[model samples]
Target: MTTGTPPPTAPKRSRARTFVPLAIAAWAVLEIWLLTLVADVAGGFTVLLLLLGGIVLGAVVTKAAGRRAFRNLTETLQQMPGRPGATAAPAAPAGGSKGNGFLMLAGLLLIIPGMISDVAGLLLLVPPVRAVLGRYTQRSLDRRMRSAAPGSFSDVFQQARMHRPDGKVVQGEVIRETDPQQGPSRNENPRPPLTP
Candidate 1:
C-alpha cells in the first residue's frame, strides 16, 4: 500500500506583471512598422504634418481634461461633509466619474507617433466610446477587487516609519532646518529632540 500526497501549489502571479510589458513592446514594434509604411505611401512632409497635428490635438485635449478635473475637485471639496449644503449623495472621484482619465490616456496615445494609437485615441475622444470603455474598465476592476485577498489592497499604500533610538513610534512632524539662519544647525541638534 502507498500513501497518497497532495501536489504542491504554486503562488499565483498577476497576469498584468507579465502581460503589460510584453503587450507594450509588441505594440511599439508594430506602431513603428505602421508609421514607416504610412510615410512610404504618403510623402515625408505629409507624415510630419499628421504627427504634428496629432501632437497639438492631444495637447489641447489633455489640457481641457486637466482643467475639467481640477474644477470637479474644487466643486466636490466645496460640497464635501462639514461644508454648506452638503448633500446625502457621495461625491464621485474627480477624474474617475467623468472618464477624465480615459481622456488623458487618449491624449497620451494620440501624442505618441503611431497610426493605431491615434485611431484608438480618436475613438476614445468620442463620448459613446469613452462611456463603453469606462464601464468595461470599472467592471474589470471590481472583478479583480472581489478576487483579491482582503487587506491586500490596503497594503499597497501602507506607510512606513523607522523607529527612533528609544524604540518607539513617535507621533510628530519632522521639520527640516535647511537654512542655517532659520533654526538650529546639525551641530546644535547632534542629539535628536524627543519632544512629544
Candidate 2:
C-alpha cells in the first residue's frame, strides 16, 4: 500500500485478455455480414428463420459446455482456503463474480442492434476469457486488501461469526448447574415428590 500512488490497473497478461474478445468480435462481424446478406437477398422471413436457428445453435452449444464451465469456477473458488469458519474466502478483491457478471453485462452491450453484442456474449461465455478475468480480478483484490486499513480483516471475521445465515446472531452464554443429584439419573424413572 503506497501512500499516494495507485496500484497498477493493467492486467498481467494483456495478450491473453485481448484474444477472446477479439476472436469473438471477428466471428460476430462475419455472422453479421452473412446474416445481413441473407436478409437482403432472401427477405425478412428467411432472416427470422436464421436468427431462430442461430439462437438454438447457441443454446445447444452452451448447454453442452456450460456445466463444465460452472464446475471449473466452483472448484477454483472452493479450493481457495479462507481463515477458519469464514463462509467465503475474501475473493480476489475485484470479486470473481463481478468480473463474470461484467462479462455477462457485456452481452447486453454487444447484442442490442448490432453483431458486436453477439460476439461479446460469445467471448464472455468462453471459459478461457472468464479464467483470465478471474485471475486479474484476484490480482486487483490482492493489492487492495494489502492496502486496506489495519484490523479490517479481523473485524470482518468477527462480524461473520455473529451473523447466522438469516442475519440473526447465534451467540449465547452458557450457564452450569451445580446439583448433580437433582439431575435425572441415566434411564431413571424417579417419581415426582408429593405436593407439600
Please provide, for model 2 over 1-196, each residue's C-alpha lDDT reduced to its tens digit, 9 standing for 90 to 100.
5588777697577786879999988876887887788778999787786556546555555554455457657756665656344455444533333344545444444334344445666677667787788789889988987777767985575567666545554455444444687786566655555443
Clashes of each: 0, 3
Give per-model TM-scores: 0.64, 0.34
lDDT of 1 by residue, 18-113 (tens): 899999999999988988898899978888899999999999999988988898888888887678888778666654548999999999988998
TM-score of 1: 0.64
Model 1 global lDDT (CA atoms, 0 to 1) = 0.82
Against the unseen true structure, what C-alpha lDDT does each candidate score? Answer: 0.82, 0.61
lDDT (Cα) of model 2: 0.61
Model 2: ten consecutive residues of lowest lDDT: 91-100
